[model samples]
Target: MSLGSRSSRRHHRALQHRAIALVVLASVLVACVFHNGASNGSPGSIPSDLEPGDVVHPSPIPGSTDQTIELARTKIKHIVFVIKENRTFDTLFGRFPGADGVTQGTTCDGKTVPLLRAPDRVGDQLHSFFDGITDINGGKMDCFAQGGYVQYLPQDIPHYWAYARRYTLADRFFSSIYGPTGIEHLWTFASQSDHFIDHERPGQFGSASREFCDDPLETALAFRSMARQEQERIYQAEDEGAQGLAQIRASLTSRWPCFDVKVLPDLLQQRGISWKDYRGENPFVQPLRMVRHVRFSSMYRNVVDVSEFMRDVKARKLPAVSWLTPSFKLSDHPPTSICAGENWFVTEMNGLMRSPYWSSTAVILTWDDFGGFYDHVPPPHVDLYGLGPRVPAIVISPWARSGFIDHDTMEFASVLRFIETIFDLPPLTSRDANTNDMLNAFDFTGRPRPPLLMRPRTCPAR
Candidate 1:
């Protein structure tokens, strides 16, 4: 009990203090990393080891430089967006030359499976949001066998293949969100989905006869909680016990299918830019119908039948922007005739090419979701929602880089960014604001290429 004992005690206290300081510093650094990631609208939990193909890299500014924006606006006056049904890039163009597609896929049981030649009418497989996550299997991309593993040859969809060979084919384009038709359609119009993760459930959402706002008032759609803590909980809950998973899912929020959020059409309206939503026989595919403003107001008139698309082209009444959707039979959805879908697509493109609008029009043809098909690429995790499986996208225009294969990592928001850039419209959400503007797909200074019309082929006898 002297000076020596007192000095030893002081040294121990100092060492403990230093340990506490180091712990606090480590905590602050971890918090900063998450804050920076979430500040940019990306998932705070993104793995540091994600591949380049597994990330959505934004352009330097919002939409590149002023010169690029000016060039886009000057060269393009009209954009025809033809969104078909669920078909992954590998499902349609897996064997196409120079495309990032695969002829084989891995299964959940660690077995390789060759992609069988899919018929014009293969059976449909499960592709719900939950199913999409299961198929991804935490980026292993090996659970498509849980759904189906099939691919179509060029002969099955001659027109689509021909279009890719003649125009710009984007092999790395992903769906804005995970599967099912309705939610992806919503993402097409609005980059944000109001946190909704899936389509309306059958019994939980009333009669399920319709998926739009016109459905029964009691109907509600389930949405994931975007709260940072909730996102982390759910993200980690994937491999947890069934009871834990159920508890997490039960904590999810829900709302009516109708959303009041701002969409691209609202910006177009503000700018006095003309646009139309040309719907095919299917009523549920029309996304504008789910918006309260468009559904209950005078803007509803802009949503018309698909037949009117060609009529408007022939009459020179095509609007500045057009969204075209096809019916179930021609949607290229499984069990539907792929030939029929290709033929319908060719007919529309042919009509546009022959019209005077062809000179200034840019036609963007793409599928909505993966449609339970086998795709080799894993979708990059952007947020709690998605940058779902890779899908086929074609940019057809006189200014399009002919026969080019673009491997840029993009989603539906990229298309929105392009339209917003060309029209000088503001982005509706962070997803679109930070996405690529798709300027790489075009050559504005090069000579405008002539249209290469394709002949529709007859469907083979089943």
Candidate 2:
């Protein structure tokens, strides 16, 4: 071969070796990135103290050797919270003459009285329909009495006691506010009871003594507070325009950090977590759904579209937490009719829980307010503030002890606190910052929980 031809062949071989080396190096770098990301947790997974597959034994809280995560630890990955409409604990569970008797009561002299004995007007049309009767003050029969009635209202009676008795109940659950749906709903999720107070009056958000009404004025005031006080100044830019309506628009706009993302991004972003706002029909702006939708993270018009949710769960694509609001027609709120809204909600949840994903899912059922329903117990007073009215709250999970009853007084912040505890995320300001953590529900001791209650369908009493 000629000398020049030999040199050309050597140069070609060198180029070929360089190309091969580059390909191998790129492959190794890609593998390292993928492994590291997986070890930390893929996007939207619950932020846990331990990595995947790492066994976490019970770890006790500092200064208290007996208090450990194991004491209440149960395998719960997805925490689904469904907050329903108004109704008090006594209004729903008061009539049942069984274990639910825990909810029976009458307000007398700053005390609560249980209606153990049947009323004298037994067999009355309304009397026979319900297990309990409301006795008017002095047993009067006036429909509009001032001091409050001792008798029961048929609509307010929670007739699902027989079925619900099988599941756990939180008797001490209280509304964050006492008045209309909006204020209570706001507190239900945000734990902000003072935001709706008539700015004209100090220390009184709204009056629970009167029927519910929403003035555009009130909405404007509330939005203003959110703008000025939200942790992120994104809600408060005067640059959006106008003092009233324009300001409200700007607040809702994505300019505000809170409104920037479909779900809370600042806290979850660090973990590659993202949330989808599936609220349909724009429930927040709709007059009918505003109160309820504002309290939830997702507001879908068709709740029965379980397939959409099912797909995520089956694919293990479920976010660490999902907030679902019932369709307007499905919610038990007035104007919307479900014979047993609570039962319907539970039935829907049970379906999700029954899926193979049950091992890692938890569902919390609660009410937005006591709706005009009667509640016998006087809510506890804390620093001169009563935590609204008594309402029902249930926690369901494969890790929950079946038939467990939690009597501790709780607020919406308890739910937030639980989520924070689960993910070890920082608490959002407002009510969540000062709330008690619901760590008592899990069993960190390493024992598995009994199966959750699963009724096939909604059952209504004849």
**C-alpha lDDT values of all predictions:** 0.76, 0.43
lDDT of 2 by residue, 78-133 (tens): 67766666555664555543222343344434355443322212121111000011
When summed lDDT is taken over every stretch of 10 residues in candidate 2, the lowest stretch is: 124-133
Q: Each candidate's TM vs. the true structure?
A: 0.85, 0.55
lDDT of each residue in 1-462, candidate 1, tens digit only: 899999999999999899867754643342233211422222345532211121234335433567876887888999988899879999999999977678999998899989999888888787766667778776678877444788888877878888898889998788877677777888888887776665565321223456567765534446443555665666555322232346446756666778777888889999999999998876456678778888998888999989999999988999999999988788887778889998999989999998888888898999998887889877666665566788999999999999999766678888887898889887777677666778889888889989878788878787
* Top-lDDT candidate index: 1
Candidate 1, residue 109: how far the Cα is off, in Å: 0.2
Clashes (N, CA, C under 3 Å) per candidate: 0, 24
